[model samples]
Target: MPDFSKLYDDLKRARDEIKLKIHLGSKDAQDEWAELERRWATFENKAELERSAKDVSDAVKILGSELKDAFQRVRKAL
Candidate 1:
């Protein structure tokens, strides 16, 4: 199983950096950020309930991929 903490933290850091750099004035960017944040919380809740690192890692991977795409859109909007 991959390290959920490391993976999640890395993604979180990257997302945060992108968010900090962007104005987030566009509706798309705001929506994407909101979705990402919602998913982040859901993944954390799932990890807490399941107590399975692999499951958490998998969930985080999906979220990370979405976050990358979303951030790309946000970058384009900037």
Candidate 2:
């Protein structure tokens, strides 16, 4: 099974970095956020291929929910 804990950590770190950049009004923060989006997309896509279809679907659902929450925090920080 995919290590969701690790994924969650990565997401958190990305969000933290994004918030820091936004707080500092750095242009590089935009680039960092874009990179985070790309990483998240790639990880989600690969997670879909590493298990049974049902498992993959469930994982995606969980990840999506977690990401939504993370994004909310990011928005608040902005």
The lDDT leader among the candidates is: 1
Off by over 4 Å in 1: 50-78
Tens digit of per-residue lDDT, candidate 1, span 1-78: 258667777877987897895675688888888898898889778766756666678999999999999999999999
Worst 10 residues of 2 by lDDT: 45-54
RMSD of each: 22.0, 19.3
Best by TM-score, which number? 1
lDDT by residue for model 2 (1-78), tens: 347657756876877776665756666767776786788778767665655576769999999999999999999999
